[model samples]
Target: MEDRKVIIETGWNLDNSYANLPKLFFSKQVPTPVDSPKLIILNDHLAAYLGLNVQSLQKSDGVAVLAGNQIPKGALPIAQAYAGHQFGHFTMLGDGRALLLGEQITPRGDRVDIQLKGSGRTPYSRGGDGKAALGPMLREYIISEAMYALGIPTTRSLAVVTTGESVFREAELPGAVLTRVAASHLRVGTFQYAAEWGTVEELRALADYALKRHFLDGDGTENRYLFLLQEVIKRQAALIAKWQQVGFIHGVMNTDNVTISGETIDYGPCAFMDTYDPATVFSSIDMKGRYAYGNQPYIAGWNLVRFAETLLPLIDDNKEKAAQLAESAIGEFMQLYHSNWLSGMRTKLGIFNEEAEDKILIENLLSIMHKYGADYTNTFRALTFDDFTDMALFDTESFAEWHEKWQERLGRQEESKDSYHELMKSSNPEIIPRNHRVEEALEAAEKKGDYSVMEKLLDVLSNPYAHSNEQAGYVALPEKSTCPYRTFCGT
Candidate 1:
């Protein structure tokens, strides 16, 4: 390993707005270090974007910085407070296993938070170890990078450093901390935390700050806060639609996991589908399927309602008036989500116009896919290549019938075949972070200390829509026997 030291200049104009609130809002502390720190994965591209020296970061000093063994100058580590409704039940929660070191303004004028996940326990650890296992750390690194490459708004992994130690979960697993960068870590649950504690003033302050930072157009108006709420709803609707279009199941859609900035925050128990079953779920803790593939839109709407309720007191002085205002904002979520979803589906099917029967044709195709168990990513990917010959993948002839109907729908469009084909290829991806591939990579890293698998997967996923004979295996769906790989929380 290299021995160069990383020079970090963290002039974090601490903007400690939430922290300036009552002491009860958050716990002031520093991160606890792991037994031994080892560099596992380094996101050199992100480091360069943040103006950090990539060559220096691949050294022992880099390992120390990422492993929480040393807090860089000007860094303030603190755990944020929040409340969440996990799996349909409301509860108080916080950054139980994560710490927000501080925020850095990038060279591009974007404010990004640098946080240490799996840093040892804080007051909010809730009697559990605040550390993360290696498997989950690797999982987040793989999937989040893939999401970024797919053009989804998401938190990007800056680095993954392994603690040369083991943590006990079902068994002893290697420990790790993921350096995550995001626009902000503020979530809907942060508002709920204020409301639950009866800190109405802090709630209002949070709303105002969030508006200025994220929804600047809604500033200085009488109904600015309400307008901000509406803006968040719109962004969230579009984000969830994007998720559905790609067959992503968030596994855990708790309000705490919903970022106010509309970027996908937590990667816990999340998975991309192999088969086209809308009811698919791979989160080991999600036994009830509340956040299944098909249920994401509805669940996102529900979470937005929770957010609206938290903001009700700040929206208006009159309780009834506040309730009405919040309700109206919440109601718009479904319409916005559906509009984006339908438009994306049309592109996937190569339809440009709003034909009256477009929806029915799309619905029937999904119905056929659900019945026959077609591979979600592969099915759409094959359509882009004009290869509908692999009908056996769907397990029935009904899929072929639906394919004919799909072709008929495409024929109604005015674009030429080549143009339509190019459009489809652009809209559909030839690569996704398949669960089996992720698992295989993790196994190699843990057992053989090899990172070749991870490096190859990242290269392929970075341009998911491109065709490459060298990456043909990556485009194929995992075998049926490997179809139901389960993901864990890595707590």
Candidate 2:
């Protein structure tokens, strides 16, 4: 892990900012080199964002570095240390199969983490081999890109490389590596780790670093940790609101996966809800529905409270006063969350101006959707582009009553009918990463080595707002199943 042992020519505009932190924050870990690495996909658009050349990256030496077979010049790779409340239980955790290779200073002067997932094992691997199967790695690439295209704040996938190796899981699966770009790898669990394991000085150092990286616009005169807490609360509120509007289920909202930078991080066991049910749970491990679609906002609030607990010592020297400040700051979470959710719902429903009855109207529509087992995305698309009466789900007597009320509401808008429908079209996507389609794409690539299917999906997903005939196939309702559709962590 020496900066001197430069093995590849990578003009990444690299700066090892996270690596410069106290050694306790991370352990120097070299990627376990893979055999016969081959580049499967490269996000050229994102490569341009990182100020990198996809042509160079598609070469053999670049593929070697990309597959963890070589380290790039100016890169100081490390496995970050942290702890998290996993499914409501506290545990120490850190990077097991991931390694941060340093930050890429983009053309826009933005610094983003360039990390390799499914790279290899590190001190945090515990008792398992830190290898990743091709299917899951490709899954992250697909869904993460789809999220980015949907205008959600999320980590972007740079590339995926097949390692010509196998990881033994449910069955022997082909191994792969994913290069993930993000605001930073810092998470709520990271602060928890600092509070629990590091000294006060170390925790302060971490907070100062985070402030410099993220909250650069803040004033120095105020309590920076308090400002940090306030910013995180606002971001999480807005983020989860967006998720709910789109019917996305994180499936596991672990403290470790809650990012401090506010970008959606982990895609493990994540899926979008087709049926508009708040009680939807898709993660196979979530038997009790702890992180169901409806529970995300609350779970996020719970995670923020844990984050607030970590900052108590840093918020003030007097412990009681610190607790009060943290409590006051965390208390604003629910209100902020509701306000954000309502605002997003308004846009989706084409409510140009809010009225006292708007929230009730939105709730009533959702109630009807849930009652009739209506398709969530299509319902909005129908309202945006077609009359609700044309859709059979809205053909009921109750729907007609609700439709009349909705028309009355729309009549009160200051904006023209065309303008408001335009707003709705932008807010509501024509396509989402539907579960059945995603599974089919993954199966084609993993089983038959046909990546064209995934590529086509990504192509259509790259523009979720646009109306296109090609996307019609992707927008079709999934075939009904006898049981629930489930996703796994795959580790």
Candidate 3:
């Protein structure tokens, strides 16, 4: 294959840090050029945030770069090597259909990975064709942005590009690519791979790189590996707590999907909970409910334990001492997760001060929600807007009793009603990327080539913290369906 050399000029201030690491960490590769590359959507706001030239990115040459038809200047394209525990089964995995172009130095002096998903295959592709369907690419764009607006830590999608090709996935579907920006692509699985395969020096090099990139605030000079473990655990704990607060179901909590930076990645089969059921599972492959809504925290803790194992050799010279240190760190996860969840829940319930009964009050509301099959986001939004009187779940006797207790609890707060309302309004989002609605948008764009529906949905989701008249339609749950709603991976 020849380099197209399309000469894209999108103000790329690329710093290929990950590529500077040892060759054992990655395999260099070039993205396969497509026949007719086209830009479907370019996130102008994100482009500006990264100091990119939006006009250039919207041009044909830039489209070529985004669609993997061309590689930008100074871009060191590679498919990272790592291993992961998929459903508790260990296996080697990498960016099969993705390519890390390079890390862009943002205008704010922050470094972020600029990767292209669905960007053809490399050594890691295995037996699969490295192509992505249009619908799933758009699904990621919509949902990742929605999560960003809702204040969750997640990788942001910069743009979606059409390959002007077809991918045979269940059917012949239009092919596409997604530009994903993240703090960094280092994952817990990367550590696992280093520990299981690489030499000790290689493992330390990986840890040192991670510390420099993400955990520099900590005193990492003496026991940097342990510091890395503690920091990652803290971040994952807080991130999962935030997910639980908003009814987010990651669907697949694989170790590879757990970002070392603690940002949410891999939106495949992921969805927001429509009804407040702890047992809710939406991923088509999750037959056992392993990654159910309620199990996210536990899964996160479990994944961190795997990460801790990787660092055992680096944490201390004595294996027994390292095991004890790692155990203590992992043991503190649930407590950290509990505190983060409770703090967020308190803000949602408009509680400013701490109380011993706060956890009980929060759980009681969840229990009532579970009993009534109430919508998760709407229930919180109802409380935010003080419009719960007409909701079917609120009309129940259990809710009536709970409502009285909630009111009494609010009365006990030192904060004024206005302050409480403000907190609740900010904490509760009026919009989430609802599964059915996301399906609707994807279908419209994929089958009909009409992006108006998706554009409208994006507009409504952009300001999740504020109230708007246009939110009524999007805020509404889908009409009841007999079949269970399921989500599929982009692969």
Candidate 4:
């Protein structure tokens, strides 16, 4: 009550470009007002990037806006409509509990989506309550920020707040909202909506808008839709490769979660692997491991096929020719993914020059890690520090053999060992959001209302490449009690 006295800044330079789309693409909605909103955290750096004054946003009015209680001036909030294949099953889905609060135009003229996750109900809420528990919302805040700090393209968390109320899940839990920033909420599922629900005119408009918004450098070819599909395929391919390089398993690669902008979205049920197992699956719903660590690239390519299918009419007038073109475009995913993955592996291994056997060498090391159950992040990070203390964990004969071959390959590069090690160190992070550590942070926040653990964890993760005695604890793999950890969708 006392906090509400602070005047809210009404200087947001917001644009409603997305709301101008065909009415079928989205539904006009406002976030349900929360009771007694309170600030949890604010990202001053990200706030400045979006041209917001941090001092103004720190006031009570800012908390009100962030909590969806007050819409900023010039803001046009709406929930987008789309569909997705959930765990290999077709389903209609949309922004059930999220609202896009207009686009913010940064000083650089870049447009970013300002969205409120856990805002409230929408037309797509289905039969469920539209709310998010505090723990999972904070989990998304932590993990998404970590991913951005790792230099991977991803939607970012700008601020988080508590509704000062409870949301019902498995049990009663505190309610919170996460302010998510993204290139745009445009997903492969958006195109699917145009294809399956809207008219061809809508589909073409979406394609043209996406080209100008995301791929403006396009050569203006006769078949611009086809070019859009190829660009999405390439982006997804490269994005997945980066995920693999960093040991990230999205846990759910549904068509809706696949962004046309190629940044990682939907942090639900996501986890970074502790051990180097290719078959690792942490999402409780992924019983068959369809979105396992090793299967991400293939799953991305599969999603791309669905995206390409949506553009068939615009790709060509002849159905058969469109199918052929789609096939060729989808076929490029594997080679592109492999090239990106191998290139990243080469950098991780400190290989400055490409070699025919580089792929094999990298795979051999991974095989050894898999056989020995070596910790993925630690293993690569140890190499950067020239610390092989855990080398004994591997099969002595096998590791020595791989090391001999790898050394021979590295010797061929003109770069000095010091420079190569620096490159490797920068490429491979010394810290990841370890499952056990994340759980501990969440438990503290939910049970005791202590956020220091999560805050300290984020501080260390911010400098993932900087190794110090202080960060050694964050780098170690958790004990077996934390193994077989399962993440929830937190719906």
Candidate 5:
């Protein structure tokens, strides 16, 4: 094979808009390299989408480029600065363990930020090593790819590289780096950074840039800041609704994790629930369950309010007017979230219309699921194939009664029963990244150098709605012994 290592030039012209701001607004620095970098995972499809040659990227030379041992040409690496409310408490944070390796404008005219996770520490490291553990890297790869397959907006993983080093969390774990591609990495916390530092000009500049990049239609509006806030609210509402529909809990809804681009950005300590429960929390750090399964919508609204506060200065010079405008924008979050969430719930239940009793039917089914500790994904998946004969899966006679009512509701719809069945089949996935299955795959990979299990799980997750007779075991929930397999923050 020809030499795959290619040196690209650093396109280092500052987008003066951000750099022109005061120095306190950001600390400019490049990514620090690791020793003995080796490629662990490569996402060829994503590379080709970005106009990169996949064949070259699969070679050892491309491994070095992705591992940050050698910087790619036209890449200018810098750690972004931002502040966030971590678990409901405001705290200053930045790209402590990651570096943004500049932006790539795809052939399709989409601007995607290429970032290196687990690169050596920067000013924002905060007394900790900036290394990432291999387990978390694989977990993110699995879950992020699953999210993408499910048709949700998210920051996609481009590649994963193992550092010939170990990180100490509970034990010595292998280190890895994940190349993450995002629509934009700007977060609500980015604005908070400027607002806290009293840099109004920088805040306005950041808002204007975000508006141009994500909400182009808001240009020249009298209340442009208000328009931006409303736009973000709409996107976030839809994003979180999808999370709920898929039984995915982010486990960390911190302000820093809330991207202005509205993509599911950070995949830390996130998991898909095996059984439905509103109080589900898998993050070891989330002891209080602040970002629990049921609280996601409320938490999203709370985060948007913080984003609104940062934009108050630009909303209007009058503080009172700004607060009023911001409040109006924030108020819309709940309604918009409900609209999307309810729509998704209806689809899950095979309900095609928005009826008054639809909410009651959905809530009652959930109540039964929680009461019986029934598997969330499987229960919904079974409903798609149900001919009203598998009452035992509902786990209670009471639920069986509710199923009859659901069947009656379906009878009222004008569409053919086959069409409703197909709709539910598509909306309710046959497989999800079950906690036990993911843990099982990770254990095998870490202990035996075997990735076969992970590969199998990925194959099943890719076609989540497809019925595969050979892979029936993949859709089954874990037994009682594996019921509480919680995920950890692979720090």
Candidate 6:
């Protein structure tokens, strides 16, 4: 592919800090140029965070750079090497369709990696096309931003650009590139690569790099590898707890998809539950209920075990001692996860102080919700309503009994009714990027070439806790589809 070059713009600074690590950690690869580049959506809020000027990013030269048609100066592009347990099966996989365009230093002295998802193939292409469809790219942009707004740690989308080319998927689809900004692209799988393929020295170097970038306090620890494992455990535990509180199913909990930074990555085949079924599995690829709604915490711990294994050679020369230490750390995951989950549930129920019976109160409500097939988001939101007299809902008698107990419990607390109302509203979002709504947006874009639906959906999701009369329809549950709700990886 010939390079149609353009003069580089100003105020762009790229730092190849990760490149200082051993070359075995990553392979150099430039983004394959696209046919015609056009800007689709640029996240101005995220651009400012990276010290990028939105006005400059809208220019023709900027679009070229964003679409992976032109590589900016000082950018050391590389396709990272990693191995992940895809669906519980270990496989060697790298950046099959992405390129890390080095790290960008923000004005606040913070470091963030700017990577191109859908950038062309390299040594890790593995016989797959290194292109992305516009729908999936937009799906990521929308959902990542929504996650950010919901106060979850996540990789943010900086921009999305159309390549003006067609890619073969279920059929031919328009190609696009998503500019992904993350704290760092380092995953547990990166360490897995060093452990299995590279030398122990390489593994130690990768651990040191991760410590400096993500866990700085680990630098002073006598056993940084153990400390690093502990830190990752803490983050993953809290992260999964938050996911459970919000009714989010990652749909895929592969080791490679889990991030050491604790931020949620890889939005593929992810969705919030419409009905409160703990066994709900949305990802089309998750044939087994392995990564279902109820299995996130267990799967997170399972992924961390893989990560802990990668560090065993570094923890201590005594493999048994290392294994014992790792097991102890892994044990803490469930304890921390349950603590966080309980606290979140308490807040959702407007309980500021602890009560011995709080767990039963929360679980009883969930049990009734499950028995009735209640809409998860709406069910929580309905708790804020002053009137709960609806009789037509499933398991109404059970829910009413539970509600009476909940009110009696709340009466014991010192909070005023208004205070409780405010807390419930803040804790429970009135809306989520519902599965049907997401499909509607994608269908509008793919079949009709209309992006207004996406734009409107993003607006509604931006302030999910706030009530908007015009956007009330977004809060309603979708009519049951003839086919079951299923999400795809779009790879």
lDDT of 2: 0.91
Candidate 2 residue lDDT tens string, 1-491: 65784354445788898877788899999999898899999999999888886777988878887898988878899999999999999999999999999998988999999999999999999977988999999999999999999888999999999999999998999999999999998999999999999999999889989989999865574788999999999999999999999999988899999999999988889999998999999999999999999999999999999999999888999999999999999999999999999999999988878798888999999999999989999999998886565356778988889888988998997889999889998999999999988999999999999999999999999999997898888888877789989999978
- In candidate 6, clashing pairs total 0
Off by over 4 Å in 1: 1-22, 393-397
Residue range with the least summed lDDT across 10 consecutive positions in model 2: 2-11
User: Residue pairs in steric clash, candidate 4?
Assistant: none
Error of 4 at 59 (Å): 1.0
TM-score of each: 0.94, 0.97, 0.97, 0.97, 0.94, 0.96
lDDT of 3 by residue, 1-491 (tens): 98785554589889899987888899999998888888889999999999899988998878888988888888999999999999999999988999999999988999999999998988989888988999888998999999999989999999999988899979999999999999999999999999988999999999989999999876636677888999999999999999999999999899999999989999889999998999999999999999999999999999999999999999999999999999999999999999999999999999999999999999999999898888999999998887976468978889889889999999998899999999998999888888888899999999899999999999999998877788877888888999999998879
Total clashes for model 3: 0
Candidate 2 segments exceeding 4 Å error = 1-10, 389-391
Better of 3 and 6 by TM-score: 3
- Once fitted onto the true fold, the runs of candidate 6 whose alpha carbons sit more than 4 angstroms away are 1-10, 387-395
> What is the per-residue lDDT of model 5 for residues 142-185, given as tens digits with 9 covering 90 to 100?
89988998878999998888888888988998888899988888
Per-residue accuracy of model 1 over 137-212 as CA lDDT, tens digit each:
8889889999998889999998999898888998888889999988888899988888888578877878877886
Q: Which one is best on lDDT?
A: 3
TM-score of candidate 3 versus the correct structure, residues matched by position: 0.97
Output the better candidate (2/6) by lDDT. Answer: 2
- Please, what is the whole-model Cα lDDT of each candidate in the order they appear? 0.84, 0.91, 0.92, 0.89, 0.82, 0.88
In order, how many clashes per candidate?
Answer: 0, 0, 0, 0, 2, 0
